[model samples]
Target: MNNDLYQEDIKQIKQQYACLDLTDDQAAFLLRHQNEPYPTHTEYYLNTWEHHDYEDHIFQKILNTAQFDHYLERREARLATHIAFLKQQDEEIKRNIEYKKQLLSYYCHTYVPQLLQTRLQYPNPFFAHRSKIRYIKEEYSNCCKVWKLRVTSQHFRNCRNYSPQLFELHMLDLQLLNIMPDYQQFKADADMPTQTTLTFLLDKSRCYLADFISFFDQKEAEETRTKKDAAIAVFGKAATSGWHIEPLPESNEERSNRLLFLLLMIEKVPDNGQANSCY
Candidate 1:
């Protein structure tokens, strides 16, 4: 890589590894040694600490004193403890991430869609019309910028309105969907950025949407078949005609976003959608 390009790459890497609490020198060292293979970010951090040169000028000054040898050993012990803590934190973060993925998968495929279907089929005019909601956005930047949303639903006293950051979690899910490895690779042109990547990404997204449609069709058919067959037993030919549910025409992205929004609202106000919030 060219010098400027390498520096940019280093900046990105530093952002990626920032959670490790890397100092400036350590961050630079990581960039320099990145050419060597490391299986994971944790391993890279561990190896960086292991091979770190303590003979630098900064350490040399402290090492020049008679009692410095004892202090150096104590400092090394503290550093070891800090590294262990970092590793422990890394493991904890991984666990939380896996749990988050499981929650998103369940909500996306089952809970959210199920609730949305129910709400669509059985509209609650009273609460639906009366409920008021407010949301605030918190934004941040790192390797990439994104928004964190906090939504509040208000209604009658003692009615459950919000479940803490649920909307933000859904927002995070949408963001993750956009940055999947397959999606990101589809958005890039080899090693460089290009304006044409937008068109390429859209095309790839359309293809994925087509596949999702097929999957949804199969799932929908399987689900309806069982329910409709059961309905026919109760009401005979009347049930055979079905309820004639029709969703509006929309792109895959539009549909997903709408469904997620509905899901978030339903989650915020579980019953009848009625709220009695002051604001």
Candidate 2:
């Protein structure tokens, strides 16, 4: 055969022998002596006797056993690295959540109480009235920002009376209502008929007379209350319907009366129409 054909045949033979369990030196020897004739069977056995000598062989086996061990080690190392990364991320998330919770608790326990106490001590009726409206405006603004952040079209909504103006107006209304008995006696002696009954008059009338405007509307007090009631009816379908009633003490103590009056004023209105006219 030509040199090219001979080379091709040798390549194929080497490929076949590559599948055998032969050592590097043995495969090299076979490739080098491929063109030589085989010796007699007895002489061949004697010449290659060293390969059979397992304990004192010159050439080692070239099996792929260690490759599997190497692959297993790599896999184990990769898994260990991945597990460590997950653990680190989990710990960081937990720490961040705990920090946020502590911050919220601090605000609720300390900041809110201090703010309420300060307002109580100062008792600026005008400022308190204005502050309620400002508070509602800020809350609504915050809700709008939240809606934007959440990428939602729905408007942020709240029913809680956060406005300082409204709060002060309610306080004033409560004070007036508590002194109604005295006002009635004075009016009776002066021979005058009151335009409205104290218990039947809506708190919104007081809000209107005192120039309290809703954050959403700057309309007259009667109109504002009408719109508010309508809105509440529509949106507050899922809201709770119960009066936060607290009994007034049977004492003429000024502090007790003031405390009780304030408590009654701060009590939330029920969802239904019953007692809705009261502050």
Highest lDDT scorer: 1
Models, CA RMSD each: 21.8, 32.0
TM-scores vs. true structure, each candidate: 0.27, 0.21
lDDT of 2 at 264: 20
Q: Find the 10 residues in a row with the least total lDDT in model 2.
A: 152-161
Compute the lDDT of residue 228 as modeled in candidate 1: 49
Q: After superposition, how far is residue 94 of candidate 1 from its true place, in Å?
A: 5.9
The digit string of per-residue lDDT tens for model 2 on 1-279 reads 787876666666557654344444544555555566656672234311222243122222333455334434554665566556644654444433433333333333443344345435444442444444344333333433442333221111111222233333333333223222122222232212221222222232233322221311232233334433433444353322222112223453332333322322332223321122222
How well is each residue in 1-279 modelled by candidate 1, as lDDT tens digits?
798987787777668655444455655665666666756662133332343343233344433353345545655776677656655544444433443454344445554455546545434331332222112000011112221221122211111222223333444444433222122322232223332433333333343343234445555565455444544544454644434212245786755433332322343322322121211
